[model samples]
Target: MNEISSILAICGACISFYIGAGFATMQEVVQYEASYGSRFLIVILVAAAIYLYTNISFATNGNRLKLNRGGDIYGVYCGVFGEKIGKCAAMFFDYFSAFFCFMSFVVMCGGANSTLTQQWGAPFGVGAVTLTVLVVVTVVFGLQGIVNALSKIGPIIIAMILLVSVVTSVTGWGNFTGNLTKIDQGTYADVMQQVGGGNPLASGASYGGFVILWFAAFLSELGAKNKLKDVNIGMLLSAIFIFFAAGVCCVALIGHIDATAAADIPALVLAEQISPVVAVAFAIIICAGIYTSATPLLWTAVRKLADEGTVKYKAITVLAGAVGCGIACFVPYKELINVLYGLNGYLGFVLVFAMVAYDLRTKMSLKHGVENETAGIDR
Candidate 1:
């Protein structure tokens, strides 16, 4: 019973970490899935398969290798080439991932501002500053602090997202097929141009790729601390839940394609269509989702620079929060999501290839070792 609870906790944490501001807002779904029209289901399924594979690989490898730092997983993945090349690759990934994580933090702040302004007419600064302070304070408490908070908050937020998305999709089913046909006929061509342009396959791959980058270091660290069986099961569950929720959300968004395509926060817009009270409730839930994601991303970036609990770590945390808030206040949230996530997702494909290579090499070597051991025993 305790073991089952632990696995569920891990699953919830994984889902929560991946949810983030863009996802909870439906901005990510708009760009990656819903914009593709009738083919959105296929795109999400493709991404979900990739998510499961990458999560399992990172977690299991992290447990087996037990590296000193989470970032070291890159070194292991690249070491299949040569020691010198591996070190270079590791250094590159470490720095690039740190920058990426920080930029993602900036996106979270922007999302917070957008959500608040759209829902309650709050000042942009109010949301940005409020989210930044909360994130920085939580990050200061470090990894365990983050895990504890996310484990509890993650499940609740995911439940709320599921409920809202499922209800919206069901209620709006009358509009769904017609909206899909309109989308296929290019009714919203201009909106599609703004959100995305890639084919379903490329978009799906890119979606999975960027998400792999997000989980690489974090899951590796998690695997190092937990049992392999538990980590594997947890990640598998997370992958299933994420894609299922995304698919449902995509259906809901498609049913209201006109409003969703134009709105900054489509999920909130859909909820508002249901009731102002539900919209208000979902706004708070979205804020919580943003908080859950921002905490780990900030921690990942800062941890790369300084050890937790050190004075340097705390100082960098505050400074990052400030800079991120400043950036979020100026940049449009949609622009940030469209540009950063799309570009970085392609870059993440490179890491995905590296991870595949590492996995293959490891399996072959293990097979060879087993063969040699059997021969010796027979002799």
Candidate 2:
């Protein structure tokens, strides 16, 4: 891949992976960050740092190792353990990606279904099936097609979200100030407790882990194909994009907590409160976010099983879509967000630990090598 093209593609893919329906609609942010009230900014900053560190590490290692699949990453890091344990970890990593992708696709379906039901008075199943069909068709064209589509659509989605968040914050200035006053009065702990359901630190850590795991495998291949500097640059730029988009959404949601507390999609709630036109525009953006994320995830899952461009790949894609659509019917949108995503966030921490350990070990070995070489030369 051309360096510039690869970098752009990687950036696009990263954004697309990170910004799903819940994220675009501000549900994830509210649950993970904004709900922390006065402490949310600290959590957000920490989350950003974690994201930056893990993504940069993944890109650098991926470039150094040139891995083809997610499983390869585990093997590379886990090899310090026994071979049998390393093999087991590698298998778990590969298969887990498929599971994660399927569940994410389900989330996309459920989120779109919720949107359709709320806005158009349509049946939830209609939205679910429609999203699944679109995602499967996109995946059939293979990874390149998914990457190209996300590269084009991801920025537009982010821009629309940022625009809506800014508008909400501006128009709902009273809500923001009122909440800020409450926080300033030292009711921060109470506000945070009521807004977010759990511990802010754990929530932030999980968010960081989830984002890194989402892109780790795909980025490894992406990093391998591009120059290291390009990969680093691409991830750095994308990290900034995610940070801004997420931060804006969190602020908007926190600003309007009273109005948004009961709403399924808080961003949409605030947008509709602003105007019907903005609401409609944001609904489309939400779908786009869900689409961009779902398409690539489905491809990642299926490609783990079948080679791209093969008949088997296409067939499995269809099978996977159908299964995902069927499963999407069983889970409520909220439960999927809290339960499924929460589970993934914790599971992601395992990968984070492994990567950190690998980095430390490598640094120590490099230091030892230099020290030994210097001593031998002096002797």
Q: Which candidate's TM-score is highest?
A: 1
**Model 2, 336-376: lDDT tens per residue?**
88777777877777777777877777678777883221110
Taking the tens digit of each residue's C-alpha lDDT, what string does model 1 give over 1-379?
3778778878888888999998899989988999888888778877887888888988888888775567777777776566677677877887888889999999999999999999999987789899999999999998778887888888788788888988889888999999999888878877653333648878888888877767888899889888888878988888888888899899999988888887889999889888999999999999999998998999989989998899999999999999999999999998898888888887877888788887887788787873121110101
TM-score of each: 0.95, 0.89
- In angstroms, give how far residue 301 of model 1 lies from its true place: 0.3
Q: Choose the strongest candidate by lDDT.
A: 1
**What value does the lDDT take at residue 196 in candidate 2?**
26
Candidate 2 local distance difference test against the native: 0.75
How far is each candidate from the true structure, as Cα RMSD in Å?
4.4, 5.2
- Where in model 1 is the C-alpha error above 4 Å? 193-196, 370-379
What TM-score would candidate 1 get against the native? Answer: 0.95
